[model samples]
Target: MAKKLSSAQLQELAIEKKIKRRNFISFSAFFIGAGAAFGGWKWLYNSPQETAGITAGTRQPLRRALNKTELFFRRIFSNDHVVKTYPKERAAKVVRVNSDIGMSTDNFNAANWQLSVVKKNGHVLKIGIEEIRALPKTEIVYDFKCVEGWDQIQHWAGLRFVDFMAHYGLQEQAEMEYVGMETPDGAYYVGLDMESALHPQTLLAYEMNDQPIAEVHGAPLRLIIPVKYGIKNLKRIGTINFSNQRPRDYWAEQGYDYYSGL
Candidate 1:
């Protein structure tokens, strides 16, 4: 014997099943719509060609936006980002000194060369190569980074920048904002931040690899600031000036970060 439901009961059961199917259909449609929208948005926003066009067309506005972004990140990070250092055994071989913006002239005379250190109150102090050699010398095998996406490790020998400043009684002048160095020919010049200039590894190098600096290597004296890009390390440093205002750098004028430090 078979049992049969009433017509009304059968209609109710059918309605319930129909409602469940409709609900499921609605949910599936909603999910598909959301996925399509997300995909479209990503396609529109994440195109490199579009970004490049925007930057090239609206350079000033884009530059401002970039500056704001950099400032925001820098503030958030608090200057704590440090470059990675390696052991001397892992150091890379010295590469060619790529830039010669300030080294074009050969008019530098080692015998007549003198390094000048200026005081805030307009007093000037001068020292000779012998004076620099008199200070305790330190040698370091460290990496040199370039702003143009390259790096090298080399052996450097010289008096540490802090030691040189200490010998000249410039340690207390911490308020100084810029350290400027010029080649003997006055063609090549650089400006550095006080922090980078006085970094423990920064050196006013007179020698490289246990030998006196070669003429091509900015001999008599050159700055070996490991914390900054190679461009900031001026060779043949004939004049060292401490300034309250930001000093003019050769590369910054040609579009580079003014505070190009590690």
Candidate 2:
């Protein structure tokens, strides 16, 4: 009752067997590769060494990588990517004063308060608030973001840093990559990239909510940079320095990124 197949039929059956075997082999390889990758990720994720990297007074490798990635993206984006602005009615009437690190001294003499500028040419200039007010004023009601994940739209008015530089004849140093600012007592400081510093909205704000800034909120002078987190907005700015080298930062030393951009 059995029937024998021709040589052509036998060849086809052989080819079908080989094809199924090849497909099975490929799928097995893929699953095995995926399993290995998952296992490696789990091991790294739960590793004590990885956790220690962040807590052991060293820059965590992962955190550093993340910071670099953020910086890279910011650099690639246009400097003109402006932060959102709101109408004056939407701005908060009472903006919170977040930190008082450098404001402890009771001897804040507003009458004699002078902002010091360190030029790239090694000349030091002490500028008064009257001189700053002489420049054209820029006002904006913009979202002020803090590192603590809170935001408020506040109105501020001040001279643009670019205009200040131009007025002081320091525009020649615009090519310098970093701007450094510090409190008079050196208790707090911040560093900024030139791109953010030169942004049109960046300001050395002296007025808030259409009035002179209160002493509790960085009276006399403060920096209002919407492009960066509120932490980068140095209060009561005392000294400004222009440098090609990256300057020291308060939060970066405490494990935050120096470029704390929005």
Candidate 3:
């Protein structure tokens, strides 16, 4: 005959059984979740490819998903959703230099830099740096985010894009669907929706950390938009054009999202 167990022994055995059952369920759940993830990844890997914004290719399903995400961000975006600014003390002392595709010119001259702005009337204005500086100056110290999983608090000063439009008599541009900007040599470019482009925090920045922008850091003029990842904060802006069609983006052509909003 089996030995009778005391009350304490019976309770201990019950607890042991309960723990084993719980562990088994937990392990089962983990495997199920992992299997689902693997299936999704495998499906994405085998998906059909399609043309990216420019010429690079991307999975059709992934591209559609990215577009949907872009639309969602666009729907919820508003001028009131401004990025918060911090005190200058919170900004980094040594700003990071990530890409130099546009600023790699050996003979690039900051003083002679001219901004080519395409007006709605089909006229191109070759604007000097002084013209940009003459506009009212606004400064912001905000978290400068990057897509590479890093960020820095930066102090930037420039002419607000909205104010820039009013100054240039280009208020009509705010009504456009998109704004496209590129480096002088056309090595780098980015596109922004009209709302993000005309946001109060967007700027045609000429200074960084209370000084003239470093040449490697986009120099005489660049763009400062806090609401976007660093990829959209174009450097060394050479040409700015208003467009009804979505502009071709350098990164987007490389399989990154066309609308790389924060």
For model 3, the superposed segments whose C-alpha errors exceed 4 Å read: none
- The CA lDDT of each predicted structure is 0.73, 0.84, 0.89
For candidate 2, the TM-score is 0.78
- Write one digit per residue (lDDT tens) for candidate 3, span 1-262: 9999999999999999999999999999999999999999999999988754452568989988988999999999999998989999999989998888787676777778899999888899898999889889999999998889899889999999999888888878778999999999988999889999888999999999899998889988999999889999999999999989888788888888888777
Candidate order, TM-score descending:
3, 2, 1
Tens-digit lDDT string for candidate 2 (123-170)? 999999998988899999998999998988899999999889888888
Q: Supply candidate 2's per-residue lDDT for 160.
A: 94
Predicted structure 1: clash tally: 1
Model 3 whole-model lDDT (C-alpha atoms): 0.89
Where does candidate 2 stray beyond 4 Å?
Answer: 1-58
12-67 per-residue lDDT for model 1 (tens digits): 99999999999999999999999999997675455442123212322344345544
Worst 10 residues of 3 by lDDT: 49-58
For each candidate in turn, the TM-score is 0.68, 0.78, 0.96
Maximum-lDDT candidate = 3
Best candidate, TM-score:
3
For model 1 the TM-score comes to: 0.68
Candidate 1 vs candidate 2, lDDT winner:
2
